[model samples]
Target chain A: MQDAPPSLLAVDGLTYAYGARLAVDHIAFDVRRGEVFGLLGPNGAGKTTAIACLSGLQRPAGGTLTFDGAPFDPVERPADRARLGLVPQSLAVYDDLTALENLVFFAEMLGVEDPREAAVAGLALAGLQERSRERVRTFSGGMKRRLNLAAGLVHRPELTLLDEPTVGVDPQSRHHIFEALETLKAKGHSMLYTSHSMDEVERLCDRVAIMDTGRLLDTGTPAELAERAGLPGADLEATFLELTGHRLRDEA
Target chain B: MKPRGLLSAAMCIARKDLREFSRDGVGLLLAFLLPLVLVAVFGFIMGRVGGGGAPMPRVDLALLDLDRTEQSAALVTALLASDTLDVVRPGPDSAPWDEADVRERISSGEDPYGMVIPQGYAEGADLILLRDPGRDLEEQLVLMSLVGALFDAGGEDFAWEMSKRGLEASGLPPELTGRIEAVVNGFRFAVEAMFDEAQANGSFDEDAAFGGGDGADDDGADGDGENAGNAGDAAGGNAVGMAEILQLTLPLELVDVAPEGRDAQLGYQVTHAVSGMTVMMLLFSLVGFGRSLLIERDKGTLVRLLSAPVPKSSILLGKLLATFFTGLLLVFVLFGFAHVVFDIDMVSRFDTLLVLTLVNCLACTAFAAAIAGWARTEKQADGVSVLLILTMSALGGSWMPSMMMPEAAQAVGRFTLTYWSLRGYQGTFWYGQHWTDPEMLQSMGVVLAIAVVLLALASRLFRTRYVRT
Candidate 1:
């Protein structure tokens, strides 16, 4: 980890607003290659907003974003999309199409030469090869999450963004998604994982960032963050609760 | 902009959309099957009303008999003899012919004709004829002539009986009565001769005016002489010629006849209606497609796709192209269905039809995209698109011909996409009408212009919404 190269995706002083409201307020973060970086926050704490900006869905009002040493401009951005992927909060895979077909479609959009082979490989990697021919609507929550991840990976993207990929999912599906993320990490794929589950952040993320009210409260390894909050023996969840407060965020 | 990359991306989106569309059986059935079912149901109903075999004009009449005499009965019988009139009696026992009922039926488009008979019609010296100015003139004439003939016959018999009684009361000599009869007969002969000469001269003048040259007059005179000579040779030929002329001239005198070479007029009307209806419905699919963009944005699929190497223009272009192709396919399917089921002529002026269809489809697709671009959610897009489409279809002459609409309403129709689409379609099937005809060309141009503007607006709006600043 110490010998790893610097962050491949970096956001500096990023700010975004929706009309009169600032969604993400001067946030800053970096995600290193081959590392699982988690953004942990309550709903509407700007986790999704920050990820949206990074994923080129929204432009920052004030800040700079770079992907792999290049400034990111969505309009001018070339088909570097082939190197990046996202597993949306909802099972973005079309419910009516077979898992294989969804993967193939995304793969083709990413300009993969052999979409079928890529789809098969992705399904195998996500441990969804058995259900490749089944429509997504028939799949369980866990299977859908796994297939969603497979669809993202069909293009063999270098970086994958997971936006609450386990929300409302069954325990088994949550476990499967974590395992799949681990596999992707093993293959040296960088990831930006956002979720509200402290335990998930502790278990899966190599580095964690806690945020509230569109501002990053802290960033470090789970244990390091705990120590910084002056709780020597406390877990990451306890540290997060103490720093961000236990009150639920009333997101609009 | 790698063309291959853009093509591949567009194909991907298209393939996905089509697959999803096909897999949602209920949705597909609603989009395609439901409209066709509605058309079939309405078509059958219209067929029944227009007559099961062919469409024919219908006239409604109300009869009143104050005299309760044989003459009145004969007049009513004659009125019933006409195939054009559907005579209805007016009374408590009969069907009510209230103004409310008449107006309601006419507004609801049940029938275009109505008539009223005054209470003292039989006793009056002149029959009070009430006519719907909106109805065909020929229909009215047929009804009037039947009643007139009955009254004339009765008046003649009454005059003859009066004269006989007067002579008997005076005890006049048979010779004096016979002389009076001869004078009346001579007057009748002169009047009849005069009427015949006037009719022949009227026909000759009409021929001369229309013929427009000395050459035509020579031909007409020669033909007339030959015809008269031939008439002398064959008794049946003369009778047939007279009968044919009466049959042709009688209808012409009553109705403003459509011009010759207009055999495809009905086909043109049907095509216009079908095309307008198709454009209106295709909006549904457009809304569905546009909503997918919102869904993607909310679910992060758009971000996922954008983060990949795909160019923004390629992504947008792909979506637009997919929509355009789908719209084109929909139009083709509708035309094909109409042709096969109704025997509507679709292949006439193939190039013009194709061009018109393509242009109209582009406009529809562009408008749909614009709607999608403005909407923040799928539901908003769906609702707005449906409302807009329904309003446009109604105002654009889908249910009735624009010519039948009030002048102000016809002007309003020009603002709707359906109007332009209908105009283009009508030009395609109707003969002697070129695409370059000012009205058709103007409509097509407007549609194309709208497509261009809408497409530009859609692209701009989409970029503004989705692209990173």
Candidate 2:
């Protein structure tokens, strides 16, 4: 077998908690360079918390996260931070501004040398070049979703953390967003995507990690997870059901 | 973080915020238009005409004529003809109201001011001008009108009485002094009638009342202040001349005095209202600006911004800078409005005003940050800010000067930033003192200190809410 690509992101003993409640447990994983890593969990399963910690939003209570071989504090290292981008679940965009303007503003904040050129390139990546000059308030849900994804990639970050980018998107818009993310993956952009949908993980993620109650349950390829669950002829969803059980999540 | 990067991030955030504000037309209206109207209305209603035009403010005086004598009539007509007093009288056929009823009308807010002419055949001379105790300017103005009327009504009688007292002290025979008094009374009555005529015709002269009136051809009673020898002719024993009578009648000359370099010019009437309004509107604007934090929180913009590589402190700094600049804009707009609408002299003390303006802006931004950090929701922040602004304005002498308020209230006012801001402006505008003057500097220092402490507390609270918590 060919030697595997070097690990671009390594999480060792990562743990985080709110006061009196643990949101993330000591869990470790390695994401190879240019691979899409899916973190699958149910509601209140610490998937979002892991993403938050990994994106440097929340300080991990007990963890060592090393990106590109050495650990760095995002607060103290703006250059390192500029290399990471987060696309949040919420539509984090200024409604009053045009798509191009919002992209330029965020791009400039990330220390991009030529923000205008990056904004235009970002719009093209999201397939929203024709509507770049329109205000976001006047855009449809899917269009805004596309713009939201574009905003995270404005600076062309090396590692992108996507927290439920398709949470509220329509079927057609979801397909468009997935295609755009796939295009980035083709260009050697490593992404840590958190989701509850097994179909999305199986179709898009190169490797998968299942976590619940702040602890990691398993980590393998979709076929490997299926085989490990003893469901030989099953797809990723059936294998996931067998491993996690059919109980209601927190939202249920 | 590099300074240039921090600055670039701040500018980006500020530019985004400004774009958001410009899109909100209604909020813009409240920020700029509302203050202009408020300042104009309050200034026009409460101020006098002495802002580079008329001599005095208008007083609303109601006349309750118990003494229907010509003396009272002359006083009433004179006051009505002049622009100083707006004389109000009952209908011609209306029944005479009691003194208690007149007092009730004024005390119960039915009338602004009332004057009672007691029926004592002009002997009592007790002219009571009824006024509300809440207003100092009104009381002082009525007293001044009374003095002016007194000069016209009983000038000669006062002079004759003074001459008679002098004759008695000089040891003149009782009979001879009595004869002098009789002759003085005849001439005094004639002078009073002449005054009445002069006032009715609207040609009332100040010099005429001091024994040098229109008919001042009585030997030594001319305008040059010479003795006419009228008292000597009447009193064969000891003469009390018209000049002596005038000297006794008007012992003290009321003269207007100003400082050596600074002229004591009459300040614009709306000055108090403008200064107080500036502070009040700034509070409103600052609170509104601070609420943007709550808005971004609700909208998830803050969280996303924090997630970026930019330092969190830079975000706060950008917002503070934006708020300070907006406040400066408001001050320029308000002062411009005051200068154009009410003829307020803003340029005379531009340096002092600018310092006070900056202090107010800093204080406002500090308080805004504090409130945003402590408040959980936009609604909570807005409600609390409104209550605090109104309370500060009331206690800090926005409606009236703190000197006119009760001692307890004045003491309470000293704790507020509003109080210090008002005092700083008043020192420069009303008292003609420079910003470096002792009292002015002290007030500005207090405001600056308050701003610094508030900023420190706000920073702590902000960190707790955004970072630690």
Clashing pairs in 1: A79-B309, A80-B308, A80-B309, A81-B307, A81-B308, A81-B309, A82-B308, A82-B309
Please report how far candidate 2 places residue A26 from its true position, in Å.
1.2
**Which candidate tops lDDT?**
2
Docking level of model 1: medium
Itemize residue pairs with steric clashes in candidate 2: B208-B213, B220-B227, B220-B228
Q: Residue B60 CA error for candidate 2 (Å)? A: 5.4
Off by over 4 Å in 1: A1-5, A19-21, A66-75, B1-4, B37-68, B88-272, B282-290, B298-300, B432-440
TM-score of 1: 0.78
**Which sections of candidate 2 miss by over 4 Å?**
A245-247, B1-4, B49-72, B75-109, B112-269, B348-352, B431-440
lDDT of 2 at A14: 87
lDDT (tens digit, per residue) of candidate 2 on B213-260: 322224433343333333322221112233344554576322223233
Query: What tens-digit string does per-residue lDDT give for candidate 2 at A6-89?
Result: 898999898888887888889999898999999988888898888877776777888788888988566466666777888888
